[model samples]
Structures are given as C-alpha cells and as structure tokens.
Target: MTVETIDTVVVGGGQAGIAMSEHLTSHAIPHIVLERHRIAERWRSERWDSLVANGPAWHDRFPGLKFDDLDPDAFAPKERVADYFVQYAEKIGAPVRTGVEVNSVTRLDGRPGFRVETSRGVIEARNIVAATGPFQKPVIPQIVPEDADIFQIHSNRYRNPEQLPEGAVLVVGAGASGAQIGAELMRTGRRVYLAAGPHDRPPRSYRGRDFCWWLGVLGKWDLAAPAPGTEHVSIAVSGANGGETVDFRALAREGLTLVGRAERYANGILYFGAGLVQSIRHGDANYLSVLDEADAYIARNGLDLPEEPEARDFGSEPECLTAPIRALDLADAGITSIIWATGYALDYSWLDVDAFDEMGRPAHQRGKSTEPGVYFLGLPWQSRRGSSFIWGVWHDARHVADSIATQRSYLEYHAQAEARSA
Candidate 1:
C-alpha cells in the first residue's frame, strides 16, 4: 500500500475535529481530518429527532463563526447543529475526509511521527490529534439483563415515545438526557418512571436571566478543577425552546414517577437503591451553591447588577420527592420498554500507544500528550470546564494546533543545524 504523509492527522470529524481543523488551517498546517461517518454524525444519527442543544445558539458558535441568522437564545435542533458543522467545515475549507475510519494509531518505527491506519489508507503524520469527543459509545451497564421479553434501548437510539412499545416505560439515569426523555415520554401520557442518580440541578433560567449567561459571566466555564469527589458534574438542561430547565424535581412534578438509582435488573424485577429524596435535595443544594458563588463574585467586583431574584419555592410540591416503590416487577409495573440514559463511555482502543493512565484515560497536560506528537481534544475538563462543549473545544484546539506547529518548527530547526554540520 502506498503511504501518504501529512503534517497532522485529526481523528473524528465532529465539533472537536472541525474546530481543531479550523485552527490548523489558519496556521497553514497540512493536516487532514478523518471521520468514520459524516460530519457531526452523533447529532445526525445518534440523537433523538426532538433533541436540541442544551445550550443556546449564541453560546454554541465556533471561534470565527457566530450563529447570525438564528435566534441567539433559541435552542438549535440536532439537524441544525449537524448543518452548522457542515457549513463551518465548508466556510473554512477544512481538509476533512469524510467516511474515513481510523483503525489504529501507532508510532512510526524508528521515526519521530505516527502511523495512522485507516479504512482509506495509511497516513504518516508528524502529529496526531484524537478528537473523537467525550461521548464515544453508550454506556449501558452489564447489570441490565439480557432477557428478550422487555425492550431496551440506549438514549442514543431512542427517537420518540411513539417508537416505543405499548405500556409504561422505565427511563434509567436522570441527567439531562434522562430527565428530558422522561418528561417527553410523560407528555405522551405514558407511565414514565425515572431512576434518579447523583447529578447537579441548575435552574434553566434564574432571576430573569438564563443560567448559562450567569455561568459565562461568573467564569464557571473556566473552572478546570473537578469537585473533590466527582469526576464531573452534569448540567441539567432541556432543549425544549432554545433551552429550558429539566431536573428530577421538575420531572417528578410532571407526573413521572421518581425512583432511586437503579441497582440491578433480576428475575423480571428492577431493584433500586434508597435515598431518592436525599439525592434530589443534594442536587438542589449544589445548584444553590453555584448561584451563591456567582452572587459573591458579582459583589466582589462591585458590579451594579439587577437585584437577586427571590428564592423560588422548589419544595412546594413535596409529594414528588417521595419514593413510593424501591422495587417493581417489570410486568407488574406494565413497563414494556427501558431507555438507558446512563451516559457514554470514551473508547481509545484504536490508540496503539502508551498515552493512557491506569484508569484508561489519556495522560496529557492540557491537550498535549506525554508522548511528544500525540495530543487529545474534546475531553471534559481537558483544560477547562467548557473543553467538552462545542463552544469550548476551540480553546483547547487552538492550544493543540499551536503546540503541533511549535514541535514541527523545532524539528525543522534541528534538521537544518545537523545538515550545516555535515
């Protein structure tokens, strides 16, 4: 096979890859983006039809391009998001090779680069950026039984309530996806049950301003350190309008039965852990703490802002917090379908290099890997809290591109010095 060479090779042509490509193009770097499917394939194929961005359009723009024609505050639908990526790629004239799947990335033998094995062909690159994104595959636990009697689908596969089998539905995992899916299912008059988990609940809008706006102003997105015991805190937002709030409390109030964290499915029965009410309360407290921190920042800066909105009574409907059942037989509950919104797992099996830690996560400082030319992008808290989001990936991308350029310059300089001596 004839081997092709490039300055850089970017894997996965989603928002992260596209952003990285834009920076590389601006830097005049000869790089190619290899995507297994179409650009933003997750938005196109994995997401539900009704799914919209959890954040507003205004905040989701790429570095140079803004959402000019669309409403800034409106939540962009999945289709629009996919189109935006395509348009962005075209606008920048990105060297993106769609439908090209990368099989493995290994060091070039006795060389100072990487060999990227792909479906198309082999690509030798001076640098490689893994932009596969944070959400790689749906993480449905092995705990979910293999029984054929009940239908099961991950949130990525779920389209709408009408697509589900007749009868009640169990939505596992109460993060943004779970809360939104449960709420949507409940609207269809289906008996929706949500399994609550450890999550953060921030109101969609607070004090007549979008919570995201406050988070931006307060530098919440700039926070890089994770909370002591948590890997990352999931934001609770719905894509109803440009965006809306969706939390366990709201879902419970919407007539969706709230249950504890799903422990296991055994013998035709689903068992749940206790502390459903406590979990809701804990999430609410965490949300309040964030608001308090923002308020403190405003005060420290002496910025004249609007008066803080009166604390809304989140506890008004206490009945929703009650966990009436800890275990339910699948048949007795009349639940015919289960949607696993448990979250996603990042896979780096294609990386045939020692750049990962014992936990199987990339060992990198910021976005640069310990192994000279290898780098990572679109990782949660890779550089900051926004690193994983569409609006945030550009920051990390710019850093990676600049780092690659610097490494290439140093290598070229050394090569010239050695030639002069010769």
Candidate 2:
C-alpha cells in the first residue's frame, strides 16, 4: 500500500467533516477527507423516506451555503437534507477520498503525528480530526425478545410504514423519531403502540405565538451565553407545527396504544410493572418542572424575548392510559416493531488516541483536544448549539480550524528556533 503524508486527515465525510474541510481550505491548509462511503451516504441510506428533520431549513444550512426557499416550520424531507450535504461538500471543493474505510489511527513514534491505515491506502498527518459524528451507531435495546416472530427494526433501517408487518406494531422509545413514526403508522390504519421515555415538555405557544417564534427570540438567539447544565442535558423547544400539538398527544389521539417501559423480553412475551401509568404521570410532572425552571431562569436573567406566539390548542389527554400521557411504557404495551430512538453515542475503537473520555468521545474544550495539533468538530453538544443541527456544525468547524492554525503557527515558530540553536 502506498503511504502519503498530509497536514491533516479528516475521518468521515459527513456534514462535520465536510464543514471542517471547507474551513481548512479557506485558510490554505492542506487536508484530506477520508470517507467510508460517498458523501451523505448515511443520510441517504439509513433514514426513512417519511423521515424529516425537526430543525427548519435556515437552521439546517452548512458553511457558505444556506437552505433557502423552503418552509421554515415545515419538516424537511430526508432527501433534501442529504442533497444539501453533498452540494455543500462540492461547493467548498473538499478533497474527499470516497470508499476509504479507516481501520485504525496509530501515533507515530518520532514525528509526533498520526498514521492512519485505511482500505484505500495509508496516510500520515500532522493532525487527525475525528469527525465521524455522534450518529455513527444505531441503538437497539437488549430488552427486545429474540423469540418474537414480529418484525423489528431500528429507526435507521425503517423507511416507511408499508414496510412493516400488517398487524399491530409497537414502536419502542418515544423520542422524536419513535413518536413521529408511531403517529404515521396509526394514521395508516395500523394498530400502533408507543413506549415512552424521558422527554422535554413544550408549551402550546408560550403565551400566544408560534413555538419557534418564542424559541428564536429566547433560545436560539442567545447562543453566545453558556447554557445551563440542565440545558446541556435536555432542552425542550416547540416541535414543528402539525395536526397534533405534541407527539405524545398526537399519537394517543390517533388511536395508538400507550404502554409502559419495557422491563425484559423473552419467549415472545413482554412484561410490565403495575406502576407504568404512574410512571408516565411522574414524567409529565418532571417535564413541567423543567419548563418552569427554564421560565424562571429567563425571568431572573431578564433576557429580552419576543412576544409569545399564538397557536391553536390541539386538545388534551387521552382515554386509554387515563393519565396525562407524555411517555409510553414499552412492556405494558404489546409492541412488535421495536424502534429504538433512545439516542446515539460515539464509539471510536479504531482510534488509538488516548485523549478520549470513558464514553469513547474525544475530550475537547472549544474544539481543541488534549493531543497537540489534534482536534474534533461537530460532536453533539460540542459547544452550546454548536452540534445541535447542520448550521451549528459550521460554527464549530470554523472555531476548530482557527485553533488548528494557531497551534500550527506556534509549533512552526518553536521548531525553527530549535533548529537555529542546534
């Protein structure tokens, strides 16, 4: 295999990687983007057809490009977002090596650099940018029973409801994806079940405005201020406008059965505890508590916000669970199609760097990692609102590239001084 040397090597040519490449290009920094597949391949192949982004067009843009002439509140189709990523890469002229799967990255002994081994070839770089992104793996719970004859798939593989078995299908994990899929299935005359999990509660319209109007005024606008610890963990802003005000309410109203959290699955049977409904009730209360906390924070801080946007009420409460249903319990509900929307984690075993935290995520502060000349960009929650959406990644990528340039300059200055003294 041929070996090459470069100033930087970016792993994964997704939005993060492409954005970083653009930043490096602007500064005349030489870098190569190594992608396992074609750019935006994951989005094109993994996401379902009905899958739409919670973020609007303006918020879904990348560096040097803006998603225009699209509905601001409308849920953008999967294809549109995927195409945007591809166009963004080409627009910036990123040097992307497609079909190259990086096996491992080992630190070189004397050069203080990294040697990246990939299927296409081997490359040595002064710095390595791990831009694989958080959505690298699909999360399916072990609670699903192996004996169940019913079809089961993760949100990644699911494309449409027609692909599911013609029976009552249970969707596990009632986050944005699960709730949206469950609601759509029920509308299509399929018996659907949704399992609830911890989620944030949204208001009808704050006082009397579009939820996004308030979010833009209050949440997205004040991005520079550091977010609270709670905000970093979970923050609830209004979802896209639809028939249902909230996902849980919409799914419940559409004749979808609500169930308790899945305890354990075996022998084609799922079991639930008696306090499942009570747990749902507690979750609702917890959501309200968090919202109230956020409101109080806004009031105390005296942050200027827009007038509460008005929205029509979609009604409240469902008859099946008999409790204020926010989250669905998996075990109590006999769901066959277990769609895990619990979230994602970064698993980087191929990376030999020791700078990662216990969770396999690279440890970084403001895009600068502990390893000299190395960095990361586009991580979920990397900086407040930095990795929340496509537009956010550009801000992070610029910051990281700037830091890389600064560090490279320092290294050059020290090296030249040492050479002259010797």
What lDDT does the true structure give each of the candidates? 0.85, 0.69
Residue 349's C-alpha lDDT in candidate 1?
Answer: 94
lDDT: which candidate is best? 1
Query: For each candidate, what TM-score against the reference?
Result: 0.95, 0.84
- Residue pairs with colliding backbones in model 1 are 74-242, 75-242
Expressed as tens digits, the lDDT of each residue in 166-283 for candidate 1 is 9999998878888888888998899988888778888777655677788888778899877787675555667685566665655567678988888977788888888787777778
* Candidate 2 global TM-score: 0.84
Q: Residue 281 in model 1: shift from native, Å?
A: 0.9
Which of the numbered candidates is closest to the native, going by highest TM-score? 1
- Ten-residue stretch with the least lDDT total in model 1: 315-324
